[model samples]
Target: MPVSEKTADRLAQHITGGFAHPVFDAQAIFRAVMDAMARPGTVQPVKLLAQPPQPLSPVAAAIALTLCDHDTPLWLDPALRQTQAVASWLGFHTGAPLAGTPADAHFALVGDPAALIALENFAQGTQEYPDRSTTLILQVVSLSSGENLLLEGPGIERTALTAPSPLPRHFVEQWKQNRARFPRGVDLILAAPEGIACLPRTTRIRLSEG
Candidate 1:
């Protein structure tokens, strides 16, 4: 079907601008994401990218612009997928292929944390190629210090803390299963208006008691 000029214009309006300087902007966002992943539970601020559709945080938009491309298969939850503006924007900017199922996605974007799909539903890379697992990008209400989860693992000197407001139901329990998968679980990037935090497959998490 041919797209009308009006529809094109509306789509364009939602398509956010990529980094001001593609190379530099991408490099900066990449570094931020990498650092967050390396130092699990640490929040890293992201430079603003194009303003994406609703439910797509500035940080999530930045990550998509920085990391996704035609080579990656992206899966958007119903909240994001149902919006043509979001689909058009992502298609125009990242050129990432949309996956039919979570297991086939290299990256999965979840706008509603409370309604997130099961962790096991996504790709868990095989032992011989553990790095191929899906990397979940979740948009949360906030990433700040409050009720937190104690994190411990390769990156922590002792233990680190993270509190992504309003996490998914049984998130800690699900994380335990994800951790038990060892070299075969999905990694995560939690995004908020302020910034982002990561929970790689190697990180260990537990609820912090009051």
Candidate 2:
């Protein structure tokens, strides 16, 4: 049976009013995610209402709510199996298409950052429109603070602070290669239960050889 238009409108209104923050909670979430993406390996916090899947953290759910819409396609790692509750919530709230493959996704989620799949498996954007790439939302163990690594690039004045713990070797290497492509690389958002951070495509990241 076809769902009633009134029911649909009510559902839309409910989703729009989901955020507790005053006016445009999605906008605030976008700012938070952007800040984190511009500074790779940094941690930031977010507020989420739904109880995410076992491995999917609150920070991840917040990202889904803030950034995703009907236009975005989401790909979930195998570790995050279909949790009916979470799926229904996402379907109603964001209406983002659930992607079946990494390359077909605009936002690919890594429920367990430590067990993230090979970076090569995902899309790397095209030569013409490099910015047409994916954004990976990773859920990390804990936000590790105190580090010597200096972050410098867009959204960064001279330098910014980053955690000491290095990302997986493969992830780092793939990112370096992606950077060389310029404009044609994936963005990243590392989220912890406490905070969230963004590493946009334009950001330049280097390991402290010290």
Candidate 3:
């Protein structure tokens, strides 16, 4: 049977690979994300789920696929935005729109942690709707290799310590400010080759004393 023209066109399109088992994979990644969010400082493992092109780590891509959707506007850092592959893969898989500015993003992905823009530049939800703030997922070298961080707040029993490598520029100072905002601040998800760790806005962060 001769293939229809529409079918032929679809077949010829070079679709970047996403999750092989979309439903199961997304569910597993989602669970990992929730675990990290709830624990605040513990790194939760996520099996490799996607193979997005350069600059977009597999873990970051999987998180985007699992958490983002058409309604969520996404912002990409300069490194990731330097090429079209990362954005194209995300848009194709998640249907998320590219936000023109960081302040407008519902979610933002940073590929270069050390050079990341200030957290305050992104969406900080108002007091009336705290959940409207931006959630940033940063691609870093490792979840366990960076400077030690002392954590204390809700979800923590007393305190927790985490070291996510190549810490963002002025992260310690920035986090204190973010915490001070209380119900209005950006939450962070640090993604590494091994897994992910979260720092919800309610969590207090400071450089650990030697």
Could you say which candidate leads in TM-score? 1
**CA lDDT of each prediction against the hidden true structure:** 0.86, 0.68, 0.88
Instruction: Write one digit per residue (lDDT tens) for candidate 2, span 60-163.
Output: 77778888889988888766745544555666777888887888888887765556676666777898977668888877665564244456787776776666
Clashing pairs in 1: 17-50
Q: Between 1 and 3, whose TM-score is larger?
A: 1
Which stretches in model 1 have alpha-carbon errors above 4 Å? 1-5, 14-16
**Which 10-residue window of candidate 3 scores lowest in summed lDDT?**
8-17
Question: Model 1, range 1-210, lDDT digits (tens) per residue?
Answer: 999999887966665455667788888889999999999988888767657776677778888888899999999999888887787778788899999999999999888878988999999999999988999998888887446899999988999988897677899999999999999999999888788789998998898885
Each candidate's number of clashing pairs is: 1, 10, 0
lDDT of 2: 0.68
**Model 2, residue pairs in steric clash:** 36-197, 36-198, 37-198, 37-199, 37-200, 38-198, 44-195, 44-196, 45-195, 45-196
Local error of candidate 3 at residue 169 (angstroms): 1.1
Give the C-alpha miss distance for residue 167 in model 3, angstroms. 2.0
Give the Cα error of residue 126 in candidate 1, in Å. 0.2
Q: Encode model 3's per-residue lDDT on 74-179: one tens digit a residue.
A: 9999989997767777888899999999999999999998898888899999999999999999998987778899999888999999989887788899999998
Look at candidate 3 and give me any clashing residue pairs: none
